[model samples]
Target chain A: MSDHQPSQKELPEAPSTAPTPAGISRRGFLKGAGITAAGTALLEGVQGFSREAVASTPKGVKEFGPEPFPVTLHINGKEHALQIEPRTTLADALRIQLNMTGTKVSCDRGVCSSCTVLLDRMPVNSCMTLAIDAVGHHVTTIEGISTDEQMHPLQAAFVRHDAMQCGFCTPGMVMSCVSLLEKNPHPTEADVRYAVSGNLCRCGTYPKVFAATLDAASQLARKA
Target chain B: MNSFTLADCSTVEAALSQLKDGAIVKAGGVDLLDRMKNGTDTPTRLVNIRNISTLRGIHSTPQGLTIGALTTLAEVADDPTIRTQYTLLADACGHAATPHIRNMATLGGNLLQQLQCWYYRSAEFQCLRKGKELCFAFSGLNQYHAIMDYGGCPSVAPSSGAVALLALDASVELTSAAKGKRIVTIRDFYLQPDANPHRFHVMAADELLTAIHIPKPAPGTRSAYQKYGEKESHDWAIADAGILLEMDSNLCRRAVVAMGAASPVVRRSHEAEAALTGKPITHETARAAGQASMTGAMPLSMNAYKVQLFPVAIYRTILLAAGQMDRDPSAAG
Candidate 1:
């Protein structure tokens, strides 16, 4: 896939919304409208979950809606009190709200680890973490790491090994590496490969990335 | 950063007192946000419950391991205690999504992640689960649908972690508005389509899955879990296998063989378990046990391949846990 965002010229024209095998009837339309209205209203208001409500509403309908919920998210050692929607993902919270854009948001889905971030000294896909759900969690984004003057050891190691190509994946890759070395200071080659199986590099920089992970681990191991 | 309201409750009673018809529990939000984004799941009130620290961490003792349902996949995977005892579950977490997803996705969230059915996800397709007349996945992309557990609604449960958890004899602690807190087995966590296809979990509307209690493995039991997908790694399992075996003087004293991505719940093989117990672990016995595991399977036209692949998984899992896959070269090689 191209690194460039989808340009309007590159985008396809809107397709016609034709009725398929089973078209929506008036009653069906009303029902769909009712559901949309209910969900939108809940997202707009962001209130009202009780045990009784849980008991009343059936499963499979996904009764959760968007709401302005207060959360105290700890990034690095700093605590941030922010109002977020129930549906707002930690990835969006970092990229959009906190303005920490180092953690890329290529795959909005949780499949790719482009949005990997540390939570309580472990790495996870920020895109999949619900901000409301992450209340009281210790979230460490790429920005939360490294001092103003000194770069983190992992970052320095990546630079030393020339591990990056386009550098789009550096932040998340380094974060995942940091998590791996933290748990296993001296990982075998297979261990390092398996640890980062979740992340992808479009430039196919696995060899260099693997070397950087090893180099960083060695450097950190010596310091420790 | 977007806006939303909060309804915090220590008990189900406080939440239900204010909740009428449209409230939803907000646990870790991994699945909740997807529902919100797709316009498929929405509740008038979003109940926040992660603050209840009591509902976190794994409780491991001689009898069993009691894991909070809200426990993160990373916690379940990395717990030195769990990695030592319940290696099956630890492997499941290590295999789920990627490192990042494992961090945010909770055991509860993984178990309750929305079905991967394309029809249900698309706003246009009104599948049977969503109150529609027919399910296009039946005729369309039926490759991933259930085989044995299909007679009723044909959706597959999306929990790879739950499968290993159940194989370890885990149970859940559910908090209800009316009934208070209660415990049930991980096997009881699911509801089959033959009973109610609309939902997968058996918990009541007012009930919340607060914790899970997993019994420790028997003295000599060793367990292993392997999830096979199209990709060698970093992908959802198209087929998954879990095995727990207790060895007594070179003879298999007890065995539990479970498979997921096969049904709405992890399918345990009683016949396979029976064949292995009180018998010496051998290549022939392992192969026979594998055959008996999927004996009564009725696969869909597309997913029938599972029936074939399932047996190999059964055999391999048995030999692997028995420490025979690497040691013995008698076809269990």
Candidate 2:
């Protein structure tokens, strides 16, 4: 499974390494030298940071690849046992297996926050996160937005301010907003914008999103 | 791209042991996996270390803040210790990538984060740094590459957090099962792509960034980190400045100036630091410091804009660190 375009390194010899002092570490160079450079370039154009490991080239699509290991995802205050292929994302486990589809998945690239979830109370793009690595952490998805019988103030404001259209980007936006508020309960408009820049809504509800966040801050402050 | 194995280690020491040879440690995977997704790294076996308790967190000691290898950027930015002791650091962390990215991107990962060059990202482009036939960015879309490369590789070091930490003079704890343990300065942890663009660090495959130690700021000191980008929301700096300055009777006794995305790593402008140190942090001194920072920029065709942008950033950042805007310079001394 290698891309054969050979744009980067036209290696006369396979890249290899042995232990050496003051030399390059010989590992983590995936070669699918056959994938068109255009495909990789397209993916790079629209992206954000993620912790998911990616192969340099696309592995053939296979149905139900056998589980690599049994990892537990602690999502929304519950531990779900999952036998996942190494490639299974934390967001997929949340939506597909746990049936808590509150965290939306679009673009599937790390760039879009549609799959944003809180890993140990911090926001991360879940589509790019592997389930195995999340085994021992607290992950709060959009499903985890409500606490007890009450919705988080941010959620209330998001709905009150009409912060969604198709609702796909809402979960990630809300999660990002809530994470920001967890630390900076009173964020400037600029802060709100910066916090949710990773998330995108085709509906372009950003102004409303910012308004909802500001509204949430005021309400949280009042409650305090 | 799909040929890889994921191996998990519960302890840093355990992760160090997983390496037979040619194994790369996966921390938060924010940077490494992004590179992999973009065709930069293809590992046969990845030794996972994010779950290692010893490798995450920020703790204060008499020496100063000790950031674990897996300590998330969010933790660094939000930690009260960092906020109080290292304001510039807090500011830089606050501005890193985005809030979502800050969650999983570790401090170690951020400093170790490789260059984000477009040519390097492409699987098809040939660049001189990847031992390629040519460096596309030399004449291509290098507006975001580097401004300095007197050496070999000319890719910009895509590290905002490192710029802040470099100002703080942080040190790294490198531990490998075979090499035991050793500490390296943050300045030493990074390399210019010209030196070797294929890998970012000299730390061994069996090694783990056990911890990063930042010494307490010097007495009577102030620091600031300011960056210029297309926009402040979630963008890499067009030009960035991190300054750690020590003052004596309102005179600039010393300063450390580091500029990022202008070089392979957060580059310290000793010339700039020397020009401002022990001076009265005057507008003239600040202007000279900025000039010093911008000097020695060997910008490629696409990034001359940074040469202009960085000088202004450095001047502004130094003044901010010197508390120039808020004070009467005549009364400051």
Candidate No. with top lDDT? 2
Across residues B1-333, which tens digit of lDDT does each residue of candidate 2 receive?
333456666666566666665767678777766777677676656676766777777788998878887888878888987877698888788777767777778888887776677777777776676776576766567778777753566677788888888889888888877768899998888766666666688887667778889998988889888777775455677778888888888787788998787887778999899898778887888889888887677878767877777777778778877777642121100
In model 2, which regions exceed 4 Å deviation? A1-66, A96-100, A107-109, A146-156, A165-167, A180-191, A201-204, A216-224, B1-4, B326-333
The fraction of reference A/B contacts recovered in model 2 reads 0.27
CAPRI level of candidate 2 = incorrect
Q: After best superposition, candidate 1 residue B68: deviation in angstroms?
A: 1.8
Give per-residue lDDT, candidate 1, residue B246.
Answer: 88
- Write one digit per residue (lDDT tens) for candidate 2, span A15-70: 45673464543332222231244235334423422324333312221112222445
Q: Model 2, residue B63: displacement in angstroms? A: 3.4
lDDT of 1 by residue, A66-127 (tens): 44445667766666666566556787676555555567877676666888888777787788
Docking class of 1: incorrect
Worst 10 residues of 2 chain A by lDDT: A57-66
Per-residue lDDT over B193-271 for candidate 1, one digit per residue giving the tens place of the 0 to 100 score: 6676577677777777777778768888888777767665556667777888888979889999888777767778899
TM-score for chain B of all predictions: 0.89, 0.92
